[model samples]
Target: MTQTLPLPVTPLTAAQQTSLVNLVRRAAKTEILPRFRNLSAHQIDTKSGPQDLVTEADIAAEAMIARGILQLFPNATVIGEEAAAKDPSLRQKAAEAELAFIIDPVDGTWNFAHGLPLFGVILAATRYGRPVFGLLYDPMVDDWIIADDQSPTRIAGAGRAERPTSVSKPGALETLSGIMHYYLMPKDAQAKLAPVLPSFSRMGSMRCSCHEYRTLAQGGVDFNLSGILNPWDHAAGVLLCQQAGGVAKMLDGRDYNIAIEEGYILCAADQGTWDTLKTLLSPLYE
Candidate 1:
């Protein structure tokens, strides 16, 4: 993710950035927190499977965040995961938009639904299909991890100070550790990836990309491999990883884009670690 980017002529201005981050915090405070453990059985529903959940909280928070984004950048296209799921065409629209804000109201919906405090809200501002700005907000802690194409990743919140962050030092593959998504991949792909797991020190899925990327950016994790390529899920985290001095790309060596339909996203601490992991994962794409 730390590869050089074709940066936009202008990233979000300081005023805009501050306002947008506040908007996300407001949504979490007003919409998400209220419904966290308060979600009634009737307020929750399934999308793809039993574990794939959407609560009233997700819907309300997305609406709030989306509306606020529109007010600030009236011409920018805003695509929320929940909305795009109801209308697939929106994904294409966001991908091609001159400026688009991709929103994941709750990145760990399953965890949130089950009363886990590990969920988060993610927002990515892309120019055309490339992420130009990214925000990963943890509602529980009321703080955020943020980055732009040209800035180092920073952690900040209401009264908290902001500080730059980076990834961990590279380590041997057997000494390296991180998260890998398995169950979500196709059965054949799962079989191909399973054998590769034991080669690393540790591998598991938190069912949440938000915290996974946050951990990687803060030097707590060496790498992250996710099975899906949804824009809302990876766009922000990809930029977060890049700004934190980590390498991020599709298994095939392509830099990430909102237009990518399917592939694993592999993010690692630095070029050497990324190259090694990429070579090991090359077979899946090959």
Candidate 2:
């Protein structure tokens, strides 16, 4: 019962913020938890290839989140994976929205369908197309990783933590070590990265960038590297990272803008890791 006030309520009342988070969490519990691992073969769909997957769980999860969010904020725009894929206009709206919910109903849809417990819900609020608040909830773990502008919160059932999470400094690019999640990058890139660091490990594509980002923010992981990822994938995660005293940016050292559909994302625990990664990655882009 360590009760404290939620921080950085900018454009939202504390009540609204709590309500929004509860709504997303409820949606996940109602629409996603029951369906996890209950999928038939037909419930799965191919997006790019066998590796890039979607399932009925993903669509159902998105719908539940969208409906719940829209019910509370009627004027609030919503950008979801299934909906955004069907209508390119949603992407445009996301880039221009003042207040909106970016939803990834079942971030690790593949894991969910396969009876793995790695997936979770990713929901974030954005103003003028910039992320402001984020929540990543894992139902199975009964944990919620939340990010407001002022602080990061990790709540599991009755327990919660409000603290800043950061990374170690950059030493040598050749000896750098961190966690990487390659969505669709070739394995060769993973192998080549070994020489760039003492450890460059891969955390399989769980489809939930929010969870990965939360892990980084909490110091559970060092970094997350991804190629061919969209804003919906990292919007909430990046915001959480910032709140947790970490940094999430493009490899080019630019702020990650939600205006774009897809780009490479690099998450580091602190400025030190960021500087090291930037120096090492610079030549590769050339």
Candidate 3:
């Protein structure tokens, strides 16, 4: 087995922070936008299956982001969703690297490929396996929801002032609204959770973690449950959620890590909600 090195505890500089956000925007404008609703049949391909997709936009945007990162931080390890799909070993290296970047170029590839406007780009900087900086960029709106170790979660761009944001206050279970990716759960787990759906005020999956995290951080939603916990998918969102005064933990109640992939994750608006939701979902894991 390869040894995993501890992540450096250094924080990102002001210029590095700015460059990370710019990288996402550049990729979206130069690679993603032109391919939206304009993909040739040959430019798209299925990865795991029909529901799991990869397109010219995803590939091109990831390449663009990867290049930008290497240019700015030449020694940093860049692990992109598409590239990881092709080479699974890269994920392990990313998890162990002192300075690493995880990129989900097109987070909602299904929605994007189908011409839906719910897709977005995600970038996370980690030391070892812990997230230190996160950026969630929406191309259509040209805005970024960002967070770092030194700052609370905030939104910027589109000529608007950067404003701090937080998670919704905990409400009664009957009045709580959240997203759950039930379909991604195991059959037995899904069966166990089926009856728990109507307990929430609103329960639905947006098929996009980017939007779900945005909603949670902006106080638009109370909680989110993800059956699949890939680093590229959850790393940035989890950090942003935590920075915005929320709680994110694995089913076993461990802190979210970039190397984790098996356990489910529950990110809630507050600790009270997290405790309640964990108890509610305990049956599935039990």
Candidate 4:
């Protein structure tokens, strides 16, 4: 397989750019916000099991996004989380497409359905499997953390400036704070990593990758680890982290690719912290 290089990206025009942000806000206002804590039993369905869920809000928001993307960029492929769940091949198609918009309409479905404000919407624009732009939108706060090839990561909202953001500084492993969502890992891998949790000053999972990435990009956390490597979940986050002067790679130390799923991924504040994290987690996969 050939490696995909991060080439210079064509920046979206001011209108085109704002359209993406508006898409997220529109979905949140029309589809997501109305259903938060308001979903009925009929509105929820299990994908793999009880812990793996899909809600009406997810479907509605994804549909809205998909429609909007096709309308705005007719040539661009739109691969949404819910749609890809129904047809796994769409995931592969998106990775291979020349221009694609990958959407995670409701990233933290469980939290949203349960009235938790931890959920968010994620959008990633990829050119031939390499992310060129990423957006993580928090509806509760109506803020967006955005990153593109042309600029550093930044936060934008109604009353706030588009302030540049970066990752937290690297710290000793024992003093580092980060997120590790262990439940998504294989049983044996979980067992292997269980004893290593105490090595970090703080080790927890927010059950929300969107927020996890937000925490990392805004200098709120040192690193983030995950065993599940879904494109919708990590593509935008990883790009945002990288643009924020952080390092993100597979546990095996390869750069992240949307085509690969099912591996450990570590995104950290800096190269040193990334190396330390990979060293600590290598044993689990070894």
Candidate 5:
């Protein structure tokens, strides 16, 4: 028999946690907020697809956030969406790092670049590819939803007392509502999942996982499904959903890891909801 040792994981000190919150807020104010609705057409660019986008705000904010992270935790790995996009290898490196900070400087760039107020910043800390902590911050709202795996605790913002979060109670499928990224799926997967869309009462995407997860944590929505699997997009939200008394996993039954390259993720408020959704959506992924 072969023996394997568990990965060494360290909890973030109170100081580090507080520093991270401040750093993200400062980056958003200085680099992201200033550039909102002010970017030139040339300042925005596309990758992978026309619907996928990046902007000067994303670039600048990522630089700021990454730099700040390095300064605060010199030994930690920092991976930004822009840099990872440029060099695909960063993703795997982050997945293996003992401590890593994965950042989505400006989530929903398509929305951010188009003068929509739906985008936000996401920061996720992973230890050996598993999320240890997650933060979803909305620059527009000047608030955030933060969680960590140890206690599975979720907090809203500064000075706000930590409160237990619960997802919407399990309900009839026809009465449930959630965010679904239907257009992001492949054509064939879309074909298979289209018929099932109406099984739920309503399905829409805010185009931003930050807001989407925030809404789900607060029970504003019952669930969300994503055909695309980007660690920076889902890692934080996965922890938040889990800590908020919800269920999150790949539709194919695999747990989410930073290195996962392909798989659809379905997150819901509870196990019953998760099982129902997985049963309904499993065929599309398979």
Candidate 6:
């Protein structure tokens, strides 16, 4: 039985936007959830290079998401990781599309295969390259996190809400740097991070980008550090963070463009925290 999805309270009313997210969540739960356990082994492959990994579950999950989207919006283009890897031209089509679904069926394939419980299915509907609808589902936890610049929602075992309690802001990085992750920081840089803000705790890394951003939005984490960020990896979560009242940017405080292969990205609850981080990172990296 299909669940009754909540009504959209934001600018997006794309016929079945609510249902679409729910559909993806349900499909993820059905297909990927069962396989979370009882795994004998997983089939894997390399993409772009050996470090980037994809698995059978990732392919199957994206296909499931694509089929659900096409069934609802036949005209909308869908660009998925596995499919786009096989044919690069689809990426061009996605870039040009007025409406396209950008999807990474499993965001943390490494963790998923290892049964570390950090993998998820990520979907974002972009209008002319700007995300309008986004959903990230963790089948392991049975959690569905949804957000759009327009309408953002979280459905969890506890309950559902349009947004969390108002987002929080920390002092500038000069004072708050210790509370955030220092991506790709060298031992010298890492040591400096602690001394920069003796009052706060040093930052840590969550290998899964989606979870890191989610924690940032929820006020549980202060910043994200990633030397190499992927469009599919950060796209949905970035939109969600911005909508949830946080800010995301490159280390230089630049706009995030999905087309870019890598970014020294930072995610904070607000501008002040971002400014502090940017200032500290500037002289060091230079």
lDDT of each: 0.91, 0.71, 0.90, 0.89, 0.87, 0.68
Task: Residues 71-184, candidate 2: write the lDDT tens digits.
Answer: 888998898988887786887787788787888888876677778888878888887667888888787876677766665554444366544455444454444445565426
Q: Could you tell me how far off, in angstroms, the CA of residue 208 lies in candidate 5 after the best superposition?
A: 0.6
Backbone-clash count (model 1): 3
Per-residue lDDT over 207-239 for candidate 3, one digit per residue giving the tens place of the 0 to 100 score: 888988999999998999987878998888988
TM-score, candidate 3, is: 0.96
Off by over 4 Å in 3: 1-10
- Per-residue lDDT of model 4, residues 19-136, tens digit only: 9999899999999998888889999998977988899999989999999989999999889988888899998899898889999999998898788989999999887777888999
lDDT (Cα, tens digit) per residue for candidate 1, span 32-55:
999889988999999988988999
> What are the models' TM-scores?
0.96, 0.85, 0.96, 0.96, 0.94, 0.80
Model 4 clashing-pair count = 0
Q: After superposition, how far is residue 224 of candidate 6 from its true place, in Å?
A: 1.5
The local distance difference test score of model 4 is 0.89
Question: Model 1 — TM-score against the truth?
Answer: 0.96
The pairs that clash in candidate 4 are none
User: Which ten-residue region of model 6 has the weakest summed lDDT?
Assistant: 172-181
Error of 4 at 125 (Å): 0.7
Clashes of each: 3, 2, 1, 0, 0, 1
lDDT of 6 by residue, 72-145 (tens): 77898889888888987776677667778888887777677677888777887776655667667676665666
Report RMSD for candidate 3: 3.0
